[model samples]
Target: MKKEILKIALLFLSITSSSTFAQETLDAFLKDQPIIDMHFHITKGYGDNEIYRHLNVDIDSAKLYWAIEDYKKNNVVLALGGGPLKYAKMYAGAERLFWSGLIFPCTKTVEQDKPCEKEFYSESELREIYQRGNFKSLGESMFNYYGIPPADKRLEPYWKIAMEYDIPIGIHADSGPPVERVNKEERPNYNPTYANPELLKPILKKYPKLKLYLMHYGGEYSDQSLNLMKEYPQIYCEISAVSMFLPKEVWEPNVKKLFSEGLGDRLMFASDYFGTVRKNIEIIYNLDWLSEEQKRDVFYNNAARFLELSDSEIREHRKKLN
Candidate 1:
């Protein structure tokens, strides 16, 4: 009986010690690491609160402020903001925020005949916007929600412009959030058929030099995503809101598969919204399966490479974070 008690005690102590060590390692890494949120969104403007509320996430001013504070606390060196022209003005001159020009208007259902009252930039307008040289990236385009395929004619000009100017494009290429949760009306136009990663093959072939990353990695299309990245070295994927939205069983295996397939360098970190930024970072940081180098790549290095930031620029950004 004494021997049994001793064995149990030893086992308990061993487990406790292991857990403590893991926590300490994670804390140390997070404290020293610089993160780039490639998929963040500015949600303080028109109808943004309503959209969050519709998804059952109640976001008041207090929550928003806390989220912003959390970004600084987590050493988020840079955040790529997607949504509204107002977001650009909101974070104008803010060293930490890089605004991407959003071209789509927010609406409840894609089937809505008329566009939402919110203005969407036209091809010409986007050209003028790009000429200003303020937008670093071209998306979080929300094309899937509007039934716009990657090969759609409307996007051809934008693709040309992005390739011509060497702008990185971040596109939403998967179905997220159950339609019932956020859409009141039937959304015939919001089907996942267009969201398949394979649809991007044609565009990639047409513009071989265009830099682009698929957001959410096409929720359930992991195979297609992996194939695309394998075929096209320029293609990358960001694991954003999917980290928080998908079940652990589903999310973990998908991420593990990506790592197993040797796509770690192409996998960038993102936190689609302010509310989930820190949470997503924590999830990725605590992933025991990932090596320290892989974690760093996902959190910062991959983004720096994708955005083509120079060594001096990276050092400067790190200085600002410190």
Candidate 2:
């Protein structure tokens, strides 16, 4: 929890330098409403206080226990904790709080160990595993990092499984994180083309019922993101790491463009980084252009619809509206 305390201290320091986040009324507003953070991670390894370290930017880092506390503190009803199977133990008993994802066609496969292989699952076999494990979604998948687009022939059964059992999916559509100034591993295989938002067109064509979302809004491809949503009603995009890296002046306008184009309803709010949830929340909650209702849509309603939160879950979470 030291990381979280340090982050709050840093953010308190940050608000002094920049006028980019929560006012007193905004804090009250956020506390009163429930949120569904569509792109949170259970991991706490953002390795920050860099690049913008002079300004004390702590947007990308937090502690694991601290993040859970933050989620409940912020009234985040259902977080799509977008990490792989290895991270599932983090939420062992807190199943109702977040839905963890399995990284499909897993990245970082060490060829010798074959650590990322998936065995065939018969219907009954898969059902038993699903009951035992909490992989509610197949996602934060590394198509961009490994340069495998959603339409690759290998993903045929993956899509079929999602359609068959109604598992929601989230994928890495961003061009991956910018290389760090130090200790950064160069992404030799990273391909920007795989991150393009338009690439999902064919995948959706085959399975229009698929519950999928572009996790990072396609890195710098926000325009294509806008068009994809315009063309296909099935597409939803969340702005996370990309926004945290940008100055609010440059970042907020991209958001305004979606609102201006009538696509704001499908844009979900996500703080992919940890401890920066309030920063990300305030980015949407205090938007001057959006009505109170519209801001709620970005914060909660849109993701709720996209993820198909059950009526009982909705009713339970809606209690925070009071």
Q: For every model shown, what is its TM-score relative to the native structure?
A: 0.80, 0.76
Instruction: Please list the residue runs of candidate 1 whose C-alpha ends up more than 4 Å from where it truly belongs after superposition.
Output: 1-25, 45-68, 103-120, 185-188
80-166 in candidate 2: lDDT tens per residue?
A: 865544454455345577787555555444231123435223455445545677667666665566556767666666677777778
lDDT of each: 0.71, 0.68
| Model 2 ranges off by over 4 Å | 1-22, 44-64, 89-92, 109-132, 178-187, 320-322
Q: Candidate 2 at residue 255, lDDT?
A: 78
lDDT of 1: 0.71
Clashes of each: 0, 0
Winner by TM-score:
1
Candidate 1 vs. true structure, TM-score: 0.80
